[model samples]
Target: MSAADGSASAADGSVNALTSALWERRPQTSVRIVDAHAHVGPYSLFFIPDAGSDGMVRVMDRCGVSHAVISSHLAIQLDAAAGNAATAEVVGRAPDRFTGYLTVNPWQDPARELGMWGSDHRFGGIKLHPDLHDYPLTGGRYAPVWEFAQRTGCPVLTHTYDGSPYNDLPMVDEVAARYPDVAILAGHAGATPNGFDAAIEVARRRPGVVLEVCGSFNSGSDIARMVREVGADRVVYGSDFPFIDLRMSLGRVIFSGLTEEDRAAVLGGTMTRLLQWRSGRE
Candidate 1:
């Protein structure tokens, strides 16, 4: 079938159309998709057979992901500078298919790290893994990142979960209030059943904060509930690719029983808006 015909079918709000497209590995051209959260490089903790950029882009093609924002596993776990460099390389190679998040290690000299790559157009935002780094989200060390984000009008994507001393929804809410200019993507949206409500409440209160849907715990129904609670504009889709299966994550959003408009926004519209400022800098 022609691309136009496919677009018509996908836009008809037929779940069967979407299901067939997914199962057949056909690109759904009708939907503009940008994966808000993703990763590259191998992780010591997990075995990822295809963790490099080439593998990532191949899957993105097969699944119809037009673009993906990535941070190298190295940046999040071992060496921030090296990891950021690796992420930059991937984005540089495929400027259209990818953009990168500059991973900042608060334990290290954050200011120095930001200074090195903050101006690079390949990097669209900053990524913080407070859970992995074991730093409290509200700690003073992350000040540089907030300040940089505010100045550049770039969004900050941070790892968040339930009941951790660091980077929970409440803690993210506190940071959002203090750095109101910085758009915050609450990664994982407080992963797990218990944290979902907390994530919704925080997004409801913080205009600058948006809930990113990803994680093993969230089901299609859970995604539908989040949209009902916070509104579709407040949620964005993320696939922790290389860590989790991207196809499964994308499938959840596609089949979540959301209306066509809501599903479109969650899949890409919201994230596209969130990244506009950074893209404008290019």
Candidate 2:
């Protein structure tokens, strides 16, 4: 597929020739896009050729992804202080290219920075991996963290799936309902595309919870149903990258069975609105 072309008028001048070239490599189905979920793991951790900062931008440029939210899996080993600092350091350089979620390991650190960092605007919210880091969201250790998030007005991202031991999906429900003010994004659509009905139901019942769609779109209707239940705005897009092909996943939605308006929201508008809520428009 050749890149899609848009002619620039004499007044504005043409866009980079490479921009159109990149678009053609994208799936037959294309949409102007912003990726809401993506991770920037260290080289040794995820073992991408050079998954460091610049590699991220390069992939974005090729895939026609305008922006991404980056997190690190190193949080599994490093304490939240170091993991979050690393995340912020990467985001700091490419403010235009990246937004980040502050990762927390409650076993090692309480993640006080989840909210406090908002003063500096370094992180968009807090990220937690229950099975990977072995912290139980339903346990008492997480109460204060949820309280702090409520006080500071940041969200929490939680990992869920059938293989994982921690059953935090129910716990996520409890917290989001208890702390109605604090927002929570169910990372990876509860980790099972087909198993997502319950999670979407939770988001439907609770306004603060959002279902983050990533790596789950094996079928086009998966995205269409997400929009139907969550109403587009409450749903967001992500690639979980260096793990999934950002371009392929975005193309899945762009070519999805959804209506054009709904597809547009999944591609970028909903995510753009979420960022706008945090930093006041991009």
Candidate 3:
């Protein structure tokens, strides 16, 4: 067919009606998309206001994101107890759409708080920001938390990067080795360009260390490379929304050169499996 015949043309001046129809009818709806990392409360360090649950729900709907695993900025940047409480309340507001990750400081008795809130239906996992909280992942103080996670099959999402002062890849690797049963998410996959390879290396060596793609600048090719190296089962999609645009983070995976099954796993399936495993659904 030709443009002259009321059909679009390629550079070769050829076209197929069936190809056009199929392209027009391509699937518009998506499978369940989950943002595995997000913040709900204000960050005192950054001086930014909170992006409440309502704000996040609107963003999720706009991007066709079915669920988000969220933690509290207040917990990471300031008070762990209050932040966990706030996260629980927000997650409780929309149990179907949101899952809370109880943020805690290693120095504190995380187990005490974990005992109180760990079984709450609104909570799915734990979040630890060693860099922000200024605790080394290898420190003995964190051992109790690790033990608890391993025993309960709780996934821990930890802040990770190349040169962060506290818990970079090296420390994370050690922790992963120590707690083999605890599901660990490297929250940024080493959030910077230099950190990407390091994150991949750690994930490759440590079966428990799953890569979380959540930064604003993570490239599509980088995500695709992670899938190639570690398999889609070990990579989960996360937006780090409000801090970074949820759309931007989601776009990285959507446009990555991954097969349909791999892309689906990264976007939601991997996390879904992690959640189910944590909650004994697996």
Candidate 4:
């Protein structure tokens, strides 16, 4: 079905159809599935045997995820230039299946980094990891990145945690307040049970802010609650990919107590709209 078509109803046994497809390791064609937050390449701290683009595509195909927006581990943690280059190569290889987030390090020349790929179609958005970079979301260093996003109307996905001095909900809210044109994707949605409420409140307060449901700490019930509280349109699905298994993360949404329409919105509809917004500006 098309992303705009929300005809899949619970009474029509759509949930059962999705569950069966998921169990069989087949694509669920009933709705378009998109992974809003994912990472590529190996990490310094962990072992991911299949962390390459090919492996990521294999898993995405298995889970019926049509598209993924990813940033490389090297870009967020180690080197933004090399990591972003790797991400561009992945997108170039499979443009239909993948789009990248231009990772910007606040400590580095963010404006120059953004200028290099700001207009590159391979990148759909910008990614920030304040915690790993040891920078606050509201820091002056990120000003250029925020300005670029605001000017281009690009989506910015930033890692957020509950009460994290770097990227907590309050910090995100402050940035979102200033850059109203940029669609701020609150990555991980605070990342814990205790943080979900705060994430919800921030999303409620900021129309440009959207909640990304991922992270190993969240439950399906938490996703349902977020949907109930903020409405399905404000929540998007993310799997952190090789960092966490895609299968289990997807299962949480499929098996959750959400209607087929809500599930569709979270899985792809919202992200599709966000990406389209980016494309339109370009």
> For model 3, where is the 10-residue window of minimal lDDT?
11-20
> What tens digits encode model 4's per-residue C-alpha lDDT throughout 1-282?
664454544335787788888677678878899999999999999799999989999888877889999999999999999999999999999999999999999987898889899889999989999999999999999999888888777889999999898999999889989987789999999998878989999989988899998898988999999999888999999999978887777888888878988999999999988887555655
- Residues 85-177 of candidate 1 have per-residue lDDT tens digits of 999999999999988999999987899889899888898889999999999999999999999888889899999999998888899999999
Q: Evaluate model 1: give its lDDT.
A: 0.90
**Local error of candidate 4 at 218, Å?**
0.9
Residue-by-residue lDDT tens digits, candidate 3, 195-281: 889989988999999999888557999999999999999999998877777877876777675766788799899999888854553
Runs of candidate 1 with Cα error greater than 4 angstroms are 1-17
Candidate 2 lDDT over residue span 170-251, tens digit each: 7677777788887788877776754587678778888988777776535557777878888887777777775676766765
Off-target runs (Cα >4 Å) in candidate 2 are: 1-23, 26-32, 43-46, 280-282
TM-score of predicted model 2?
0.81
Residue 270, candidate 2: Cα error in Å is 1.8
lDDT of each: 0.90, 0.68, 0.81, 0.90
Whole-model lDDT for model 4 versus the true structure? 0.90
Count of backbone clashes, every candidate in sequence: 0, 1, 0, 0
Q: Work out candidate 1's RMSD over C-alphas.
A: 3.9
Determine the C-alpha RMSD for candidate 2 after optimal superposition of all C-alphas. 6.3
